[model samples]
Target: MASGLGRGNGAAAASVQLGLWTGDAIADRFWKFYGEETSTRAITRLQFLEHVGYLLFLKLDHERAQRAGRFAQQPVAPVDAWPNLALLSGDALHTGLTTLFDELGDQQLSDRPDRQTASVVFRDAQPWDLDRMAELNKLIVEQIDPYRWLAVPQAELGRAFSRMLRDCRKEIDSKIETGQTLTPLPVLNAITKVLGVGPEDIVIDPACGTGTTLIAAYHAMLAANRQLPPAALAGADLDAQMCRLAMLNILLHTGRPFADPAPVRLADTLKRKTPVVRSGSGAVPTVAICNPPFKSNGVQPDATMRDDFWAYGDFPTNFLQHLAITLPQGARAAVFVPDGVLSGGGAAATVRQNLLRNCDVHTLLRLPTGLFHRKGVKSNVLFFTKSTPKPSGEPATRHLWVYDARTGNHHTDTGNPVTEADFDDFVASCLPEEGFAARTESKRFRRYSVAEILASPKTSLLLKAHLTKELGDFGSPKEIAFEVADRLDEAAAHFRQVAEALPGQ
Candidate 1:
């Protein structure tokens, strides 16, 4: 909590006392304002949000610098200096914003990686066009006050910015490519719990969107009393705007200087020569967590990629293979993947077989449906540890535990969102502190040997322990559609297996 912000009383559950507004509330105002004000020559909702983020970033930094007595040396940082909005208006305000952004790009962020991301955030940012600058001024006055930015602590502001990211994503969700999805915080927590991130471990996300996964890992590290430097976390994403957002997100969470080089890089993870690095004082990544793109058509066949990366012919499998091969031995990873990667025949089967052979593939949790941004997409989290070379050439994995959280459960984006408690039973079943023998099976949890897994059709890892069928309450239309799609996927996998068993091609 900030010094001035107040909490609501018992009766007013959704109320914020002392006029402290939430990030969701601020985003709603921005979107509504954009719809009513923006015209043909104006910016899109995405561009408007980026501009707002820039202003917010500057305002937050100004306050931080002022408190530290370092504000005197910076170039015209004028956001918080104004006592109120009445002093600036119209063309003058627009020109001032343009100059500030220009100076920010040219002077402050002109270095290597920072310049790259700043170029994206401030690219062609013509604030004078079609009343956008005026709109921004109006929003700052009415919704997000500069005084509020100064008053809130960095943690609260970071939380607000995170919530704003989630809210704003819903507005621009259609603009991004298919298979790009945002992970809800609770889902991120569940994945991190399985990894059990420690103080000394370095964490990375290959497909880091908005840096939420890395933020979750940061918080987990903080819980263990870790002294988190900016170099403790690293990530990469193909989208430049996403890289910018991730940089801002991590900066806000870590309380790093505003001009530090982004921990995330704007490079295609599949093409990067070295996937993992031990940067300045940062060690080799010991834990990796990601929700990779499940159905990306953008990943085309390229000669630059290694042959093993193309084993399953999809981004999800490629990412899995990337982590399996790139992460140092004894590193742990938890990846969210679609069901096809688990049950598909041919290349998918070969990939699963090799994964089990090369890594200690330990736990498979069949996640509930409707957990992702895509409608009706079924998914799961695969946990494993990279192993060292075996002199005898035996498989690395021994026993695989499967937890079926999808059978009798459902989740939704709005109506019934996923909570961390929803994963409690599954997390307990993982037995993070206990060794393998202490684990016990339940209705939704069971263990299978490597031999049994290999003998299954298509070498499928989509094993489920829950045998009880769903009761009479057929869920919402989305749930029904998800069930249908899941069944179709299962049928397709089985058909592929049957076809492979035929005498001739």
Candidate 2:
């Protein structure tokens, strides 16, 4: 565990002063920021999030400036951004932002070789609000009360900004043709707990949308007092804007120590043959957790991995198989894949079989619907360990535990959002260090032998026998007696048959 987390000068306590409606207010303000042009929610949200993400970085930079004050004498440092933010108006907002954006181009300390390229590369890679900074200032006043609401601690601002953007993601579900759902904070934390992520351990999220998994991992290590540098984290995204926001998110959470290379890279995991992460301690993902895009252009589940070529297929399935195959031997991963990956036929079935044969398949927690932006889509987290070469007949996996959190529990993006507390039992049961060997079947959690999974024609991971959908929780006395009697009678008959068939008899 890392030490001295949450001890930063600008770090806020558990209780932040932001209003309950602050996230909603930010959402409402963004909609208003774009007048009555009435574009698709997807585009509108991208524009809004782009500006807001930059704003978060700007706020942190301003706080850094304040901390660097020089006795209010000998003229303030040339890079102070807070002084202007206080009296920010149209031109002031633009000037402050422009100066900040321009400063990001400095390659004085960049790790890249090309000094000029490193300076402007970050800005030039993504779409900009530089030309429209003045327009955003009007939106800030007409919508976000920048002076009043933006004065919170840098950490709080980042959390609030992230929450608002996730809320907006719910509205863009219909407009988006691709899959890029945000992982709920509680779920992300629970995953970290299950993985037992350490400070020195290398972590990667290949399908890192806005980098929530990586962000959560960062905080987890921080909370554990495990002080990890940006080198310990890596993430990649197909979208440029997502990569940019993820970069900002890492910058915000690792506050005060803002002098490191951004670990996020912009790349499509499926399209790239090589690694998506360009610079880290290494390209290997020791502990991988990703909610990769689930669909392949709204097409069928035809992703393939034969003869060194695959034109198209289920994206999530391909990513999962890729993670399992590419991860270093003995590496473990927790993948968020749709339920189809569990029982779907054709290439999916082959991949599932391969995963089972090679990996030490541990647990499968069926996630509830409404947990993602995709409505009515059931998902599951596959926890497995990659093992080395073994005998042909012997399988790496033996007993498998399946936790059915989705059956009775329910969650939503809003209203009743899932939190870390919601995953208490699931986390306890799924963790291998927490007496995993002594685990037994609970009401919502059950243990299945690997034989049972292999016996299934589809290699289906569904394990809902004890679920409410199967048997009544509180059966009548007669029903209980009958069930017990049936078990005893069957056992007795089997024993009698075996006894009669003995050679002596």
Candidate 3:
């Protein structure tokens, strides 16, 4: 697991913190500095993030080389060798940074296959205004020490980056698009626990946002087997900034070098010929975990059409179909989908029917509303496995288990983040670790036959739990407020769609 860190660092280094500036604290300090920069300078949040990403990359690489004693015998160092050179003022710092970016670009092209990846990350990346860039470097070196970054565990560092990204977007306003949102970590943990990822399993997230889902899967794999299997992780994102963040996140989490090609790349997963493939084995992904963008428009008209486009439903359903068709038989998937995918009519219903015919749609988990950065957004997690077709051409799914974790579970983004405790009953009842134990059903958890599920109008999978009087079969005023907020959000979304569809919008 500590393969990338040099001699004195490993499992022992996981808990090491330098003086008072811990890893989490360092990330917080960076975020605070980011706010100051964005507020004072003329730079946007996106531009500042790009600047910081480059600086952090350089600092981390320098720390790694020092720990490994790479320059012990060298007579003279390269221009980029001394990260401390960033502390200089005016012309010296400017010259040092210009040459540093140049040397880094040249080194990235040192390999053949990695050139394009380098171009994607380093394209248009040059030094910003001297004063602003110098301030950022000073923050990294003086406040957040270079060696402190290497002292903490890689997973925590990766998570720190994720949190910082989330905070930057949430607290500060910017022109950045709202297409990507990081999945909450507790929710991610619950999904990975249900999937039970192992060392040998190749996990892929086609819509990876900052590589959160992939990192969670990596940690799950490490827990299953005490080894680092970075090559088994793969992801892709359409947004270039998101791809950059995912690359940095993966590098930090896996302790891989900046030069190595991350499992993640920049591409539209739906448009790519092969959406998901293991970088290590070149085999089909054994496990898929996705949280696709919500309510995105269908593919462009110029793009080639395929049957699995599935009635031109939203991206979530299309991504679900992509998994249903592309994954090999017996491969498993756990996808975070909106309530519309489970309950909406027309295209969504058809996709659900086709999914049942092709895959064993086993579990439906109704997640709490406002569980993401975006409020009033209700979502669900569908757990399923690809199955071989039956001789008699019957549907693959037999019994469907639905867990209603949403009703009366008024979890907001700030007030109550979803936690492992929230998933205890749901996990123990259906998703046990070892073997197939008998699952005891409760009021919130129920089992339904496929025929009964299909009998519902439009074959909707949004089944409500039958809570008894003892279980408090009622909604409080807070629940009513949440419902109202959700309805208002839906109405606002509908208006936005209408406005967008109008001429000259």
Best by lDDT: 1
What TM-score does prediction 1 earn?
A: 0.80
The lowest-lDDT stretch of 10 consecutive residues in candidate 3 is 3-12
2 or 3, greater by TM-score: 3
Full candidate order by lDDT, most accurate first: 1, 3, 2
User: Model 3 Cα RMSD, Å?
Assistant: 5.8
Question: Mind sharing the TM-score for model 2?
Answer: 0.71
Deviation of model 3 at 58, angstroms: 1.0
In the range 77-155, model 1's lDDT, one tens digit per residue, is 4445433332466777776667666655542442343344344445445564645557767766654443545544556
The global C-alpha lDDT for each of the candidates, from Candidate 1 onward, is 0.69, 0.63, 0.68
Rank the candidate models, highest TM-score first. Answer: 3, 1, 2
- Model 3: how far residue 355 lies from native, Å: 0.4
Model 1, stretches more than 4 Å misplaced? 1-48, 68-128, 141-145, 148-150, 176-178, 276-282, 307-312, 432-436, 469-475, 478-505
Q: Model 2 Cα displacement at 53 (Å)?
A: 2.7
Q: Over the stretch 375-473, how does candidate 2's per-residue lDDT look in tens digits? A: 445678999888975867667888888887776665667656787777898987766454778777788788888898989988887667345674223
In the order shown, the candidates' Cα RMSDs to the true structure are: 7.7, 14.8, 5.8
The global Cα lDDT (0 to 1) of model 3 is 0.68
Error of 1 at 188 (Å): 1.4
